[model samples]
Target: MRVAVVQVGYGDAEPVPERVERVAALVRAQAGHDLVVLPELWAPGGFAYREWQDRAEPVDGPVGQAMSAAARDAGVVLHAGSIIERPGGGEVGPDGHGLWNTSLVYGPDGGLLAAYRKVHRFGFGAGEPKLLDAGEDVVVVDLPLRDGGSVRAGLSTCYDLRFPELYRRQVDAGATLFVVPAAWPAARVRHWTLLAHARAVEDQCVVVACNTAGTHAGTEMGGHSQVVSAAGEALAMAGADEQVLSVDVDLDAVAAWREQFPVLRDRRL
Candidate 1:
């Protein structure tokens, strides 16, 4: 599968609407890729906590609309990074934070394929924990391939990358590819690269991680968006700037590697 990972940057200077328009164009530019991914909270600044509540919108809001159209135009299954979502009709979840950091996936036909709310909230009682409700679902969707076959892809965002159990559950659900969109900071970027490869090695699945770049809200985003093969080899990686890392991945390689190693068969617990 040919994948395009868009490493976007969010700054205080650019207006949100303009950023949306620019990013939509970027998505449209990846016409031949089978799958395209964007970084988390590119529309709403990742560290701009003060602006999240004001900018929150529903799944069908402007961001989703533009992404759906862009996905159709590009003719690729697009992971439109994440958005700050406010549930419509005044509904509320368990935490009652009134908002969620949600990742959206769109099909080639611009149809809504899946929406994964981030299960792990960051900020340790601040930021996400204080402002947003936690997601309860483990999301996995089948990505349609050019050859008429499909690959099961598990969805998680940002801080969820640190939790191995969540990915293990996805592996149990028959996911061969893990799609992660993060807004990880530059301070802990070393952990980001290490954990991405670790997830691929431990789960024996291909890991596609897309992260942001540039500074927003005084925080520098880590932009080493990468693709790791089932064998934990880094197939492609982007620099700490706004760029795109396009790589061709073999979906069948996951099955082949797992069968050859047969490590998962020995799991007792």
Candidate 2:
């Protein structure tokens, strides 16, 4: 599968609408890629605590609309990244936070394929934990490939990368591809890279980690968007900038590696 990982950045100076336009143009440019991924909360600003509520919108809102059109125009499946979703229904979380940090996926036809609400809120007492409700469902979707078949993809947001069991669950659910959209900061870049490799090797699956770049609200984002093969080899990686790292992954290799090692089958659980 051909994947295009778009590492984007935006600070307090750029307007949200303008940022959306810039990202949409990038997505539209990946016409031949089977899948296109983006970083989390690029529009609402990942670390911009003050802007979350004001920038929150539904899945079909302007940002989603722009991404849908972009996916359709480019003729590729697009992982539009996580958005600050201000959904209705009056539902509340454990901390009384009603909003959700949601990840959205669009098909080649510009249709909404899946929406994964982040189950693991990042902040301990502030930020996401205080402002957003925790997601309950584990989301997995079949991303349609341009060549006719589909790839089973498991979805998880930024903080979820630290949890290996979550990815083990994806592996059990028949997911050969794990898509992690993160807004990880520069301070923890080592953890981001190490954990990504660990997950790929442990789960024996393709790991596509798309991280944010540039400074947002005085916070520096770690921008090493990468694709790791089933053997934990880095297929492609990007630098700390607004760039796209495209790589080709062989899904069949995942099965081959698992069969050769056969470690997963020995699980007592």
Candidate 3:
């Protein structure tokens, strides 16, 4: 499978819709890939937490519409990155709060494939828990590949990378590909790189991490978007700037590695 990881900026300085449109056009231009992944909170800047409630949209709202259109035009599966989502009336929690930090997936036919809310909120700096609620479940979806086999994709957000258990659970659920959309800071670029590879090696799956580039609300982001193989080899990686890194990964490698190592079978839990 051919996968593209996009590393771009998301700052309060630019108009959200216009930026989304521009990136969509860029992704459409590179349409030969089977899956195109974008950075976290590509629609609205992740650091723009103050505007999340006001800028939040429904699942089928304008942003979703735009992504659907782009996915259909590109003729490839698109993981459009994270968005601020407002759940319906009764879907809100007991506190009556109704929003989530969510990621969406669309098929080549412009149909909605999956919606994953970030289960582990990033509380390092600004403390995401103060603004966004945690998700209740994990999302694992299947996408048909051109090779006549299907790949199981797992959804996760920025801070979720710090927690290996999440990826392990997804692997147990049969996910062969792990997708992480992040707004990782420049101060901790090493952590971003190391953790992504660790997750892939530990879980024996292909890991794709797409992160933003520019500064958002005075916080500089490390833009080294990367794709790691099941054997913990870096297949392709971007620099600390805006870029699109694409690489081909054979899904069968995951199975081959798992059979050779068999570490997963020794888990006592």
lDDT of each: 0.95, 0.91, 0.87
> CA shift at 178, candidate 1, in angstroms?
0.4
Winner by TM-score between candidate 3 and candidate 2: 2
* 10 residues in a row with least lDDT, candidate 2: 87-96
Query: Clash number for every model?
Result: 0, 0, 0
- Misplaced by over 4 Å in model 2 are none
Best by lDDT: 1
lDDT of 1 by residue, 16-130 (tens): 9999999999999999999999999999999999999889999999999999999999899999999999978987889888799999999999999999999999999999999
TM-score, ranked from best to worst = 1, 2, 3
Better of 2 and 3 by lDDT: 2
RMSD of each: 0.6, 1.0, 1.5
Query: lDDT rank, highest first?
Result: 1, 2, 3
**TM-scores, in order shown?**
0.99, 0.98, 0.96
| Deviating ranges (above 4 Å) for candidate 3 | 124-126
- Per-residue C-alpha lDDT of model 2 across residues 1-269, encoded as one tens digit per residue: 99999999778899999999999999999999999999999999899889888998888999999999999999999999989987667666676777889999999999999999998988887788888889988888999998899999999998999888888888878899999999999999989998999999988889999999999888999898899998999999889888899899999898899899988888897
Model 2 gets an lDDT of: 0.91
How much does candidate 1 score in TM-score? 0.99
